[model samples]
Target: MSRTTPATLALDRAGVAYELATYDYDPKAERVGLQAADALGAPPGEVLKTLMVKVDGRPACVVLASDREVSMKKLAAALGGKSAEMMKPADAERLTGYRVGGVSPFGQKRAVPTIVDAPAAALPQAYVNGGQRGLQVRLAPADLVRLAGAQVAPVT
Candidate 1:
């Protein structure tokens, strides 16, 4: 599989340090992020799943550990919005310029507000999608927060 992607390019442009990892993506897996963590043999907490959401009807991005689930109520509160919900799969793909399972917070088609779960943000290293299926980038959570301009919150 190709190692270069818009996600990597964005990181490069920002001078963010990260390592690329590739694995066999399982389309049949019920949870993409869990499958990715298993494929990487890493802790579930260190594998972040990028989710596209609409907070108060506005597009937003959320990054949280693969093992956790987002609390929509908490998410809304964090964003100072009234409500939050997952974006439609197709809508998410369209908005982020990536397929459902390959969406990454970086290099999105449009810049949107981003929230990183407090737990994930505390990790010294985390793995996230690399703008494509079967690819992930390992980097410090600090770098991810800084690069994505993500707000850290307990939304999960």
Candidate 2:
């Protein structure tokens, strides 16, 4: 467990409680979220990945299950945009203040609109990147929603 990261601090400011989980990180892993789920010994569906996307050229955050893919059409519609695409890794990092493999929905450099796929709320608790690679935070779905100021939609 490490000290407070911006993500954790955001949770603190929101009066949200969470537990931290850390594991050995392998840069070679193709899917960061899958790797984290495996390390945390949780089902892939219980772990969410924070994705940076451009909806009509505006940056936004989308979170979904580790095992699922975000549907661009659905995400765009959710954001009232015509189209959406994944953000470039460099741009995503710069905008979110986190590395490619460790983007979190909270504590961003700027307040970006966030959408959390509805499926994530099905789980009792969810694991998400803790603003750093190899670190994760577990919290109730309601807390996550509140902390991220996220809208829930069927975007996965």
Tell me, by TM-score, which candidate is best. Answer: 1
Per-residue lDDT of candidate 2, residues 97-151 (tens digit) = 8888888888999989999999896677999888888889999887888777889
Give the clashing residue pairs of candidate 2, or none: none
Q: Using alpha carbons, what is the TM-score of model 2?
A: 0.96
lDDT of 1 by residue, 24-47 (tens): 999999999999999999988899
lDDT of 1 at 70: 99
Q: Which stretches of candidate 1 lie over 4 Å from their true place?
A: none
Residue pairs that clash (backbone atoms under 3 angstroms), model 1: none
What residue runs in model 2 are displaced by over 4 Å at the alpha carbon? none
- The lDDT for every candidate, in the order shown, is 0.95, 0.90
